[model samples]
Target: MPVARSTKAQSIKQPRAGKAPSVTENVPPEKEEGCQAKRSPSSPQGGPKKRSAFGDITNAHKNQAVTGKKEGVKAPTRKATRPPPALVVAKNNEINLKKSLRKTPPTDVPVEPEKDSVSEEPVQQVPVVEDIDKEQLGDPYASAEYAKEIFDYMREREEKFLLPDYMEKQPDISRDMRAILVDWMVEVQENFELNHETLYLAVKLVDHYLVEVVSMRDKLQLIGSTAVLIASKFEERCPPCVDDFLYICDDAYKREELIAMETSILRTLNFDINIPIPYRFLRRFAKCARASMETLTLARFLCEMTLQEYDYARERPSKLAASSLLLALTMKNLGGWTPTLEYYSGYCAQDLHPLVKRLNFLLTYQPCDKLKAVRTKYSHRVFFEVAKTTPMDMMKLEEKLKS
Candidate 1:
């Protein structure tokens, strides 16, 4: 105080923009109490304890009043601390409102505006297909098992359903030549990783076309190649080219020769591209059995394996498909064939003798050791369940196929 010698005098600092005047310099210490007294509330310990804005007394205020009463006043026994009626109703209303809000859609959600200029378009409905009544259809396979009955039934059915102008054809190759052709074709089909239907149809085509048309000896391999090419085209989404067919034949047949043979076969068949393949039969039979897809696929692989065999390829497609599916179910340890399956498939004991015999023989025999070798070479999973059969049983089947 003697000489509070210019404490901040030397530094002539400018005040900042929009700054309030410093309280320390503008108001003296003597004026501080006067400002506080003027600002003081009429009552001190906050407002009186009553209902809150939402109409509920705070518990803390209630507790303090009870504790602060006269010492002997029996601690002002607390009443049941229920919320006021108004507050309870308000809370219930809030809950109900929240629930309704959840149920109601948002008001600001975007809606498509109707176009006044556009006319309403009429919808064209498609006609639904009616289910074919099985009772009216009788048995499609009535002739399948009982030879005489099926023969007569098929004759009538053929006359009723088949085209009258259909040409008759049969396989012309000698048994041994046909067998050799079948074996070669089987090998080629397996090499290509092709569907059994393709090979089966190819074999059928070779047999059918040879029966009807007189082809050159030089064109025999070409016939096989062309049949395979056409069958592949029908069966495979990504069919091999004509050059690929030539390559499969080790270039024994020229590319032009294969193409010419393919054209001839296509013409001979009258471009009636529909071939009744075994896979469809297999699927239908599998469905009837309620066999799983994996079982069906494995059975299909087995069926395809049979397509390579000359004897097996000659069997009816239905028999082939049924036997494959049945054997697959057996291999997978899925036992118990249902009556529905039997009735639907027409695979009763009386009907299934030939098919069962073939299937039993196939399941029991068939020297798949070579197939195992190929499967192992490629590490293919097709033979994953091959051991589901036995060598001793397989030998027995071998002996039976011979018989």
Candidate 2:
């Protein structure tokens, strides 16, 4: 019984030694040194041919060399590697399909009507003559010459009611000086990016009010500036302050004086403030006549020249506008002002025949030497006036004004 037990123990020990040889041969290079110190090599093929449990190729053969047991080792053999041709063909087909899809045509969709339509309605005609009376149309003020009569009456009033007293009072500044001031003020307004209409209306208001309100005893410059201040506030969103107004005037007037003048001017005009200025009319008519800037400037000078004439007090704003435009047309050599423009003027004022006749008379009327006294005596506010020394070229003006 003791001998049988000894043989069983030896059998177990023999197999254990053989297993150690195989494990040492298959160990990786990293583990070979430690593994060799504990076990001997079995066979070289043991490292190369042995398949791991996970079937991965590792440094098993390298370990055999490190252990000095590589003479019997064989190189690792792997299954032949190839991708299936069907898979490659399917990938190419997918790419071609994407390319062909990009070029496919889009479908057109049909649109439906949004709403149903209703039946058409018949036209209606209303009478205008029945509403207006014939007697009203035939009144003297309603006649074609009504506008001319109004202008004539205004001229008479200006000469009779406005000019005599104005002429009697001694002028503080010469006509030439006033004209220079006017020109300079215009330049300043433009430089300051101020409203041209405000400046113009201010000038017009000063002229209109001065004809009746203040005497030549009062400072005209103060009146002009006062008008400008009032006009600026009325026409501009941001009017220049009183200091700025005085600064532009070279501090000629006090701050209190300007404010006082402004109040006085407003009161004189009855606070109506909506005085129609020649500058506004000039631009409108210049556009209508399609006149160039030079022509416009000359016409404006002529219109402004009228402000110095006391005779314009009674002159209708429209007549002044029409006459200035016609005179400018003559100066510019533009033959025959547009009838359409005339019609437009008539339409704007709600009266046509007066402007049409005014345009005709202004085009045909000849200026005479008899008016030289009138021209020389009248104080023009826009250009330099010379001393009474020589006669004007009435002949040239006559020929031009006639045409």
lDDT of 1 by residue, 5-67 (tens): 443332212221101222123333454444344234322211121112112222333333333
> What lDDT score is found at residue 20 in candidate 2?
26
Q: Tens digits of per-residue lDDT for model 2 on 31-77?
A: 44433432322322222222221122123322433343222222233
RMSD of 1: 24.2
**Cα lDDT over the full model 2:** 0.50
TM-score of each: 0.48, 0.43
lDDT of 1 at 360: 58
State each model's CA lDDT, in order. Answer: 0.53, 0.50
Location of the lowest summed lDDT over 10 successive residues in candidate 2: 107-116
lDDT of 2 at 310: 45
- What is residue 256's positional error in candidate 1, in angstroms? 2.3
Off by over 4 Å in 1: 1-173, 214-218, 308-314, 331-333, 363-379, 382-388, 391-403
